[model samples]
Target: MMILDQFYAENFGKVYRSCGNCGTQFKRIVQINDLWAVNGDVVAGINTNFGDTATIRTTQVDGVDDICVKYTGNSNGAEPVEIGSGPDTKNCLYSTSDIKQL
Candidate 1:
């Protein structure tokens, strides 16, 4: 696994990586000021995943804006669909079958 900080210096940037075993293409976006819980501390964690396509959105809550991630994929028409969506503070997981929006 690769640390998010290694790929992005700030949030709101695109990251590209390919699976070594399957050569599956993956893309990720990092949003700034993303909140994450690691080791009981709510610090900014690098949010990322692997997939074929992705979309990102930003919302304002209580006068503060936040970013969200959404991804979808079906690798070569395989079984199991992956979808993930979540705030910038959390990490997401994806599989080859489908996109997982966290």
Candidate 2:
């Protein structure tokens, strides 16, 4: 079976999406194009609107947006050694002597 699913987001002209489980602000639309594919009545008196590409959305956790930053941490068995803005900065997973997160 072929399943063609699309997110029907109709507004007076507009967006933000929510999560299912946590119910927090999960998705926020930065830009939206109402007309992904508008032929503008190309063939006779019919306006063909074909959707192209996919809808891409993003989420913000604890107001963390910057993905490129440095992570440095020191953990002497205290507070689990939190890193880089508290698990939001990019490349926070990697650990090393120079760029280490404790």
**Clashes found in each candidate (C-alpha, N, C closer than 3 A):** 14, 2
What's the lDDT for residue 82 in model 1?
A: 27
Backbone clash pairs for candidate 2 read 73-102, 81-102
| Predictions: Cα RMSD each | 12.5, 20.0
* Candidate 1 Cα misplacement greater than 4 A, ranges: 6-13, 16-68, 77-84, 88-102
- lDDT by residue (10-86, candidate 1, tens digit) is 23332322221333544434332222211221112222344322222221122112223343333454432324344
State model 1's lDDT: 0.29
TM-score of each: 0.24, 0.14
What are the lDDT scores of the predictions, listed in order? Answer: 0.29, 0.20
Backbone-clash count (model 1):
14
| Model 2: residue 93 alpha-carbon error in angstroms | 14
Relative to the true structure, candidate 2 reaches a TM of 0.14
- Specify the highest-TM-score model's number: 1
